[model samples]
Target: MKKKIWVNIAFQVGALVLALLSTTLLLLAAGAPPFQAYAAILKGAFGSAGSLETLLITWSPLLLTTAGVLITFSAGLWNIGVEGQMAMGAIFTTWMLRLLQETSLPPALTIVLGILAGIVGGALWAGLAGALKTFGGVNEIFGGLGLNFVSTALTIYLVFGPWKRPGVGSMSGTEPFDRSLWLPTLPDTELSLWSLTLSLLALVIIIVLLRGTHFGLRLKAVGKNPKSAFLMGVPTWQYSMLAFLLCGALVGLAGAIQVTGVYHRLLPNISSGYGFLGLLVSMLVNYQAVWVAPVAFFFAAVNVGSIQLQLMYKLDSSFSGVMQSLLVLLVLLGEGARQRFLRKH
Candidate 1:
């Protein structure tokens, strides 16, 4: 176990170094000093209180949504549909807001409704994959991938049709949510305290559930050896569905938090592809909950800091995403190599 962990760590470090090198190459292409660009990237990520705030703002959603992915991954399910689930979550919450637009309820209560609505939306989207895998005899990867397009189309439809803001472009969305329904902000910080707390609580709950429960053990078994588990009388399909539902709910929570805490309004492109970026984080950390925190924060830093890199060294801001993707690919390749080397010995 120790050896395996060390291997994972080594691969993680190697991938990070390669990511940095890739960024440096981009800097050189732009006729800038690579070292200076690197330093500036670091400085922008953590150089001041303002930078820290920006990092946290980005970190909030990444952390929550990645943790959601970690849940299904633990059960050996690839829920690539988190993007759609998140979109549905936003759709549900926004619709809830619109429905109650005329209600004179307290902002707190309406906020709760929006959050719950998001949870339901996400769970429903994720549930479709579970259903397909269980009854339709479909592979989850393709099912989830297909669902993402559907959800994106649904989001666009809502914005352009029923949810269109009055007198605005037909391709746009509804009026901004009520100010009272906004998520409370952390004192002296752009971060949302409620959202952060919910994510932290989710991390703790998932850790305990996965590490200390019979259900977790069975879930692990289903992932490691599905046939064997089924022969042993474990209801693999049921457990898999359970996993999908949990993943959906968590992803939905992420969407709800995004709208309430950060956006305060819906957009067709509201997601920023954070759900996709989260997949890279999960793989990089080897699905370890503790490691997800830092890995996500670092990714968020790079994402936010890349703006400075663009300005200082003429680097394209897209460099950060390319770096993240490369890191995930390298880690997987390195792991495969290590396993092959062991088999040879």
Candidate 2:
């Protein structure tokens, strides 16, 4: 077991090195100094207190989304509709805030209610996909993809129609929520400590649930071999749906945070591809609960850091996407090679 752990660590490090080298070559080919670009990246992500705060803000949603993805992956379920779920969450959060903007309720309580609504919204969307897979005999991947399109269309319609900024029906999204609806940020920074704390709390709960609970063990059994697990009396379907529920809720929380704590409004592409990025993080960490946060933070840093590359070297921010894709590819290849080597030995 220790040998396997060491091997995994070594492979992860090797993958990072290879990814950096590849990114460096790409930078050189683009006629930019690789080292200087890298330096700028670090500077953008961590040079100032404000930049560090931005890094933490980015890390918050990533931690939530990746942790949620880990849950579904552990259940052998591919929840490809996380993007839709997140969108739904944002929509619901915005709706709640808009509806109660003039209410007499305390702002804190109103915010809590809005967050809950977001979670419900996300769960409903995820549940629809899960139902299609479990009962309608549709593959989750296809069902999820379809739902994602529907969600996107729905959001666009709302933004352009009823929720459109007064008489200016642009895709910019609904008018910003009342300032009272906004989540409290850290002093002198746009970073919300509430969101960060919530993310950390969620991580702890997820780790504990997945590693130390009977339900978790059952889910693992179902994932490993559903037929065998069923023979052993595990209700595979129920557990799978439960995973979807919990995962959706977590992702929804992230969306709610993004709305209230970050963007402060519903917008087109509010998810910002974080759902898909979370999928990659889950894959890179092999869906291990313990590794999810660190990997997520690293990816978030890469994202936040890429801005400097864009500004300093006139490089496209998509370069970060390229780096991320390369890293995932290399990590997957390394995992396969390790498995092959172990089998041979």
Candidate 3:
């Protein structure tokens, strides 16, 4: 246990170093001082209320998506379907909003319905992978991936078909939702405390579920050794499906929050790679649910910082992606080395 903890910590440090090195490379490549670029990113992401608001906006989706990934990961399942889940969630919420526009339901109730639609939408899409894993003998990774393409195509078709607004593929999406259904934002910041609160709630629930329940124990058992777990009478497939369902619901909530809080309409790139970033965050945090929060905030800062880096240093934003990839690779490698060292000792 001590060696495992040390290895995890070492991996995290390696990731941070890798990230810094990449940023420095980008700065040098652009013929700018790396320190100056770093300063700019920091300033741009948190210099004022507006910058902080942008950071919060960026933080929301990553936080929620990471939390979602944690569910399946805890159960030793790989769920790469969060991007598709998010898209479907937004699409479902938007469709429901349009369908219920003429109803006399209270605005609050309408908003609730939209959120529910998102949750249901994400679950169905993710549940298919779980089902395929259980019965069709398909791998969740490939299955979720294929479904992602389908989900994207479906969204495009919907916007161009019956759901199309006056201008198809325009930013406003199928139609502008009524103001009543929109999530209220804080006056002091563009950030919606309500949505942020939802993320916090998810984090708490996941921690409680994963570390404090029979379901969580079963999931850990499955993750550690499915055959042994099965022999011990654990229903591995059922647990896997449950994990997927929980993941979908969490990711769906993230999508709904984004639609209701930030964009107010579906953008084709609405997910904006936040799902993937969340994955990186989860890995860097060593799959510790509590650690995800701080790691997510750090990632959010860097992401927002990259926007500033591009604007101020005239550097490409791809620098952030490069840094993130390097971090993930180095961290993984470090973990491997640390484990090897432990074995030798």
In order, candidate lDDTs are 0.83, 0.89, 0.83
Query: Which pairs clash in model 1?
Result: none
Clashing pairs in 2: none
Q: TM-score of each candidate?
A: 0.93, 0.97, 0.94
Residue-wise lDDT of candidate 1 within 110-133, one digit each (tens)? 889998999999999999988999
Scored against the true structure, residue 336 in model 2 reaches a CA lDDT of 89
* Candidate that beats the other on TM-score, 1 or 3, i.e. the better one: 3
List the candidate numbers ranked by TM-score, top first.
Answer: 2, 3, 1
Candidate topping lDDT: 2
RMSD, every candidate, angstroms: 2.1, 1.4, 2.0
- Tens-digit per-residue lDDT, 105-148, candidate 3: 88888888988898898888889988988899899899989888
lDDT at position 111, candidate 2: 95
Better of 1 and 2 by TM-score: 2
